[model samples]
Target: MTIALRRDEAGSGPIVERIEGGGFRTQEHYFADGVMLTPRRAETWAGTHDAAMLDRAAIGQLLAIWGEGLPEFIVLGTGSTQIFPSGALRRALESEGIGLEIMDSRAAARAWSVLRAEDREIAALLLPLA
Candidate 1:
């Protein structure tokens, strides 16, 4: 397979470049802004196309990059698919004054690109689900 390199609406891809600020850059994919980690499936998780619920492991990775603690809003792209988060996780984050928005991988990639340009501390999680 061949890869292309160019400034795209989603990301730069084909060749993954680790952006200085955060996130992985490529021709068509821009993964998490801080570090691109391979997220493992949480136990007992019923996956959805529009709502891939985030488990503690994924959340931990997000928080680590979000060293500033809680961000104004967090955009989670549930893999290549877009799955909403489980209710418990949403409520938990809300209780901590964090805004969470679950979008599909594509939208999440776009969202991160837009947000990163302005917000220096804002972070995102983008993964591809099988």
Candidate 2:
């Protein structure tokens, strides 16, 4: 028996695929009337059980985009199945008058999508699964 491939238009928006072979290559694409907006390219990272491995640069990029907005809240994903925030990081954000929540990457992605769909420009730091 063979399983048939089904095409899903739902949530299929502009896709920016990052292919990693001998090296990494990024490609941007657009989807019409789909669930997402413009394409975005992101670099993939190795996942570790330790939250200390979180990439600050990636987090910074997301913050830079919504920094001017100075959202009341921000969400971050630590990758893998673990989600937690460093004390120093939290303190820094608080000092800047921004509240933050940390969760697994998967949850963060879903929450970001939901919040973004609401038309709110909430900043999200998501660690994509490799």
| Number of the top-ranking candidate, with TM-score as the measure | 1
Model 1 C-alpha lDDT per residue in residues 1-130, reported as the tens digit of each score: 1222233343221223333223345544554322232121111112232344465455765566444446676677675556777888888777777777787655665566555444334445555443
User: What Cα-based lDDT does every candidate model obtain?
Assistant: 0.49, 0.45
Query: For residues 70-125, what per-residue lDDT tens digits would candidate 2 score against the true structure?
Result: 66676666554555656776777788787777876555555555554555545555
* Model 1, C-alpha of 19: deviation from truth (Å): 14
TM-score of model 2 relative to the true fold?
0.54
RMSD of candidates 1 onward, in order: 8.5, 8.1
**Ten residues in a row with the worst lDDT in model 1?**
37-46
lDDT of 2 at 123: 59
Worst 10 residues of 2 by lDDT: 30-39
Clashes of each: 16, 0
